[model samples]
Target: KKKKKKKTMEMSLNLASSSTSNSVFLFNPILSGKQLAFPCRHQRIPKRVKPFCVKSSINLSGPRQTLSSNWDVSSFSVESLSQSSSRLPSFEELDITNMLLRQRIVFLGSQVDDMTADLVISQLLLLDAEDSERDITLFINSPGGSITAGMGIYDAMKQCKADVSTVCLGLAASMGAFLLASGSKGKRYCMPNSKVMIHQPLGTAGGKAMEMGIRIREMMYHKIKLNKIFSRITGKPESQIEGDTDRDNFLNPWEAKEYGLIDAVIDDGKPGLIAPIGDGSPPPKTKVWDLWKVEGTKKDNKNLPTEQSMIQNGYAAPE
Candidate 1:
């Protein structure tokens, strides 16, 4: 019963150019460090005085690589800033004419019953009825909450008329990660430091532990329900999901991908966040996902995708 320690970092930046402005958002993991370190936060430089580049640099100890962002004058959005937070994702949708065709989208964020899904659904409705389409990348960063809620959101994603891609940021553990993976039309992805965990669901009943028999039955029920969710995503057996859940260790990005959980490796393209605790938390982490996938499907318990296969496919090399 070992656990993998995980760190998730979130960041945001506002950029201005004439009448239009844009915000870049990201959530990345410091999953590649020996000592669990993070980079320094950068100041928001004034747009006029700022160089053409909105440069941010980060250095981490051990296997973690240095991450930097230096944007060019050419890379930017032309949309005006007279917008609402609700309107932000709408910018990602596109317009296609002479067809009722819709684009793919995988909307991720908070767990079900969370406001994240509501906004996503409404946005999709607008895109659908208004004669436009979009495929989406749902960038997810959540610790997980509410099992039924998560499944409800997943169903919504399936019902969406377009393609959906879910990019895991930070921790996609528990139901949060579960729903995130469910969004992919083809497959799921994770950042280098991303972590995914699944275990039997748990609950604290007001009834005393003295009612041990009933509680035992209830726990078993939860186990079955959780196993079903895992089975749907990975094509793995419920028994396997139970085994992994009971073991209590977290799976790093590579392990997750190998297990048929994540499809590829992607950088959320953001910095790790450091709180005042002075541990390995800082800012200046801006990252984005560019998908790279290996071909071939799963067989037995092995993962094979190339003419040259992996030396060891399941675990990330230790930091």
Candidate 2:
């Protein structure tokens, strides 16, 4: 190879051209595993710095995770790509946004699987522990999934010290609707166009006759539990809830409010009914939630020791 002079190559380069053209020239000759250095007029700039390249692994774990990696290059223009990459959030901005969201907001926009349940419950518990007096907002827009997972979230919301304000954005269906109704009373709201749907727990059982029988029994138990929840929240009869949920029962915002599923239809700027505080009245308290405690089931305390029996033993309390 002939050795080229630095002065000859410097004159051929155009300073007025776009930075992308300069980048192309910088990498073209280096593909053959050889160092190609070019001289520039600016002495203040550092010389012979190689471009940094990053290698990333493709994740194929889930639909959501996989979809983020597969981008259509033909859909985006080069200018849009350049602008998007240049305008990424700084570390400080990202940290601030994350902190704000964790402190006050719990958004549920996807199907409520075990992972979603865990994340929402953990955030609610942590926020309640941090500042019990402050209210936490939960925005839900889910088509519903996993009755067991949704029940976990419902229990967590009841156990938390902070009052959760549930808001419906697009649609809250099935388990999602149940969670919305489980929020602190007088704090539930749905948008003007949002839809709320309720129905019986759905599942597909596959196996022998015994296994199918067990699955049917379990599903019936969940349906009964959910019906009781709706009855309690909406102040309706359990029979009425059962009849309505026999099929898909979708309600508009006005219909939801009329059915007592939500307190108000959010039309103005007010985010549902405000909780009354500092009016010489006792603050509202939360009940201890027991997921397995179905109604009409009596606890057998016959085996438990009474106070009289405790006195005969050494476990008596002294005055």
| TM-score winner | 2
lDDT tens readout by residue for model 2, 4-83: 65554454454325333333344456455344444333334568889898876756564543211333334355676577
The sequence of per-residue lDDT tens digits that candidate 1 reaches over residues 244-309 is 676344777766767877766654322212111223221232233112121211232254344344
For lDDT, the strongest prediction is 2
- In candidate 2, which residue ranges exceed 4 Å CA deviation? 1-92, 95-103, 268-319
Please count the clashing residue pairs in each candidate, in the order shown.
21, 0
Worst 10 residues of 2 by lDDT: 276-285
lDDT of 2 at 239: 97
Which whole-number lDDT from 0 to 100 does residue 172 have in model 2? 99
Total clashing pairs in model 2 = 0
